[model samples]
Target: MRNWEDIGYLQIGTSRQRQAHAAFERLGILATLNAFGPVLAGTIPLNIDLPSSDLDLICEVPQLALADFQLLLRQHYGHLPRFSLQETMVRGCPSVVGGFEAEGFAWEVFGQPQPTRAQHAVRHLLVEYAVLEAGGEAWRQAVLTLKRQGLKTEPAFAQLLQLPGDPYAALLTLENLTSAELRQRLPPLRP
Candidate 1:
């Protein structure tokens, strides 16, 4: 099995050329995930240009009460950053859990009210550690469905793979871009 550190480094190296403080974030996220169960572990729709300093996360704790989850946080990591619970208009009709900022990045949570038919199907695809950790057909189908819907899969995939967002976006964006073209457009990464 690949250690989180190795997977994390691979993600950083493949996504962006620059080395950033990723291991610290990785450890923090692992601690949170182990403590909180399966939840969103980082910022979504990451900035494609600049680096993000913190992990943004959320989860649907329908089976567990909000207070219970908060208790878990207090028991493990103490006070969390400021965030709110809200429901809002969203493309996927996402259920809002709350919004908060941690470290330097913002985190939001939404407990999806009731799963839509599409979501119902997507949610049961056997995600492990937030990734499609098995059942290749299910994973592929889910990815295609999300892609056709014009949803963001790359970020989710990165989280599952334990990679940072900026680098992930960088690699995805650069796949079709030539080296010269990329260098001409994006600033050089300082070592």
Candidate 2:
């Protein structure tokens, strides 16, 4: 599916993705955060996750519903291992973050006063997915190798692409390009 909202595709994905699907099902994470419009983002969904990668769930939580959202998370997930909930600002927007470990994966639930699709994490995921699809397996392996060597997803891509300045923002610059344009702009694939 082009949209990452429906996670059914994960069931047929890589082994780690299948495991993630099972964990999500076991915890009912998306259902638990349904009211907030949760969308799974990050490396795991893209099949480039490191062994230590955590599940990143992004949600839309309006300011008025902040308390209820926090309550719901605490009520449902607080008893999970290492449960912690807090409020902070991300890109100047107020955000609620909760974390817990379940079924062998660390789960991070993030809520912002904006649409999940509009959040940077989801946007980055979409762009990164496009890059991976166009770059083929070699590019994917390069990104994974960089990640294993201690780089975050964005920086790994940035380093391979020779992108300058803030890797996060640089990646976004390629967000709207067509696949053809991306292929043209991307450096030749390396072995």
Candidate 3:
């Protein structure tokens, strides 16, 4: 079989992202989650979804009554399809993790401590966006092909695509590259 991937935006629209964030705001989940630190990181925000991608969020829960915050999320939004908010851990600290749907997007939020959160960069999403901006459909599909073939992380995708740097480093540096530049960056596939 040949390399298969996504050529265009996923069927979901950008509005879904706003709606989810809005729901977080309207429900005060944003502010509540923010007490620890706030961020939405994952395939959804990056707009790079596989056929089965779900939303992932990173948050840090404060030691002060984290249980109360998590409970609030579930009590307020649990009615949503597949909602399952619960206390969880990230890098050995406490967090809340679960999924909920809003305006047609499937979302998963993970609350993590500030220090642990710092190590998780959303730049991968930025890199994907930059690649999308610079290289358009072909680059996206190529990356998706790697993803579809079970190369989940960006670095693995970049490595398989023969990109010039560490998968992580290359993506951070790949912004504004043209289609030709992208093609140029790709070394010939090994036999």
User: Which residue pairs in candidate 1 collide?
Assistant: 15-167, 83-99, 83-100, 84-98, 84-99, 96-110, 97-109, 97-110, 98-109
lDDT of 2 by residue, 1-191 (tens): 37688899899999999999999899888887888889999999999998899999999999999889999999998898999999998889899999999999998999999999899999899989989888989889999999999999999998888899999999999999999998888798666
Show where candidate 3 strays beyond 4 Å.
1-37, 115-123, 126-137, 155-158, 161-191
Q: Candidate 3, 91: how far from true, in Å?
A: 3.2
**Candidate 1 residues 27-118, lDDT tens each?**
36446544333333331212122343233344444334545655544544445567455445444653445555554554443343343212
Better of 1 and 2 by lDDT: 2
In model 3, pairs of residues that clash are: 55-108, 59-112, 60-112
Ranking by lDDT: 2, 3, 1
User: Relative to the unseen true structure, what is the C-alpha lDDT of residue 163 in candidate 3, on a scale of 0 to 100?
Assistant: 66
Off by over 4 Å in 2: none
Model 2 error, position 174 (Å): 0.6
Candidate 1 vs 2: which has more TM-score: 2
**lDDT of prediction 2:** 0.91
Model 3 TM-score (2 dp): 0.59
TM-score of each: 0.34, 0.97, 0.59
